[model samples]
Target: MTPPLAVDIDGTLTDSNRALDPRVLDPIREWPEPVVVATGKALPYPVGLCEFLGIPVRVIAENGGAVYLADDDELEFHGDREAAQRVVEEYRELGHEVGYGKVDFTNRWRETELAVNLDQPLEPLKELAAAHGMHVFDTGYAYHVTSPGVDKGEGLRAVCDRLGVGIEEFAVVGDSENDAAAFELAGTAVAVANADETAKAAADHVTEGSYGDGFLEALDSLRDA
Candidate 1:
């Protein structure tokens, strides 16, 4: 079997506005192997989107803090949940906008990481997280606070193990600083035209288009490979 395709959501599958092109769904579902939706978004949103698109696949949510397999409909958390929660409280105490409770409805379903709206600069947040022995990642959509060792690369590695695939057989598509780890893990790392410099620099191929168009371009390349 072909290695699975792991893709980031915010700036890869969807545009800046979080709008997915309907055209990408059919091809994705028709792909030869599994299509894992790896993202910084919470589990529900990605799982819901996959359902609506009629695409059955596993999901790596909360920026590698959790994994949800659609077949079994189970969520397996990978990060230190208590530590993630503590970081949220710490961020809140530090006067950052950390979304918990009803602060951000879109972020309500997350369990292992804290998602902060992009109302402030991320460098300070990263610094603060480091002070607390945590890590902060900017996903172009939000800032994710996770345990120091957690990242999308780990999530993809887990997915590969569960599916009996190897990292060298996988193709990863992403467009943010948070995507750097997974890009490093993939045999073929593709960055959309709109990708942040760090992500692009980590990629093996940079697409000419942004969002879904870029994803489609990468998918074509992978198929032709």
Candidate 2:
């Protein structure tokens, strides 16, 4: 059997305009194995995608700060919500916009991270996290302030266990720094053509196409592997 597949959403499976390319949906419907939508977006977005594809899949949301199993409608969180809320307050006081009102509807449901779209340098955010006993990560779209222990890698590991598969049986695809740890854990680490330098450096393979096209290519290769 082909191993379970894990993929990032934004900048990997979605187009530059943040729209899901319809081309990728049918292939997902026919996939013989479990597909995990590993993303930083909230649960509802990915759940809606799975529904549109007419397939059952797992979700690792909040940048691995939380995991949601579609079958069970269960949620497993890894970060401290109180600390995350405090980080949001700190960022707002520092004159940076933070929270759902500033970003989107998903921000209101976020439990473990505060995502900000300040478009500022990340170093200062990292410094702020240090003071709050937290960690900061960039997902190519926004700055995420989260608990130091929460990440996509941890989420992937949890998903692997739930699926009763090992990391070596998995092929992971992503396009940013938050995906680095997951890349390290997968048997085949693939980066899309437009992936960040760090993510490309960590991958075993880099697809020629970008976004959904790249993900389709990677999934085809994994199915044949």
Candidate 3:
């Protein structure tokens, strides 16, 4: 039997320009095993994507801060939002906005972590998060400030426990630093050609194709395995 799939969005499922590649829709929708959309994006995006794709709404969002399982209609939050918020507030005091404008919808509905625009300076932000007992992970799209002990691997473990599956029984695909943890836990970890060094180092396989094409390649390999 095919293992359940946990996939990232952004650089993994999108084109170079970060637009969702329409080609990935059918395969993911038709996947026989459980498909979990794990992303550094906020909860709503993945949940809405699953709804649109006609799949169960299983997601690990905010890097690992929030998890939702459709079977029990359960939404669990594991990160310390107040700690993250404090870090963001300090960042703001340092004369840097979260990079999104006043009406920043990017973080409007986010419950556990803070997403900072890539344009903002990263080093200081990382320092600020660390000072607050949080960590910053760059997903190639944004800088996510999350509480300690929360990451994609831990999120996948949580999902697996709830699904009655082992963490080693999943196939994970991703392209950035935020994905490295999940890659370490998955039985088969695939990194797309566009993956960063961290992700590639943790993956068992690296696809030649980039973006959505890489994702498709990984999917085909899983189906054949």
Candidate 1: TM-score?
A: 0.90
Model 1 residue 141 CA deviation in Å? 1.4
By summed lDDT, the worst window of 10 consecutive residues in model 3 runs over 71-80
Tens digits of lDDT, candidate 1, 1-225? 355788888778776688887778888888888888988888887888788878885899888888877666666787666666776676677776654346577557778877777776577677777777788777767778788768889988888777777887889999998888999989889999999999999999999989999999988988888
User: What stretches of model 1 exceed 4 Å from their correct place?
Assistant: 1-3, 71-74, 99-103, 121-124
TM of each candidate vs. truth: 0.90, 0.92, 0.98
Error of 3 at 91 (Å): 1.4
When superposed on Cα atoms, how far off is each prediction in RMSD?
A: 2.1, 1.9, 0.9
For candidate 2, lDDT tens digit of each residue in 114-187?
Answer: 77764655776777788989988877788888898788889989888776789888888999988888998988
The local lDDT score (0 to 100) that residue 219 gets in candidate 2 is: 85
* Candidate whose lDDT is highest: 3
Superior candidate under lDDT, 2 versus 3: 3
Q: Which ranges of candidate 3 are over 4 A from the true structure?
A: none
Sorting all predicted structures by lDDT, with the top scorer first, yields 3, 2, 1
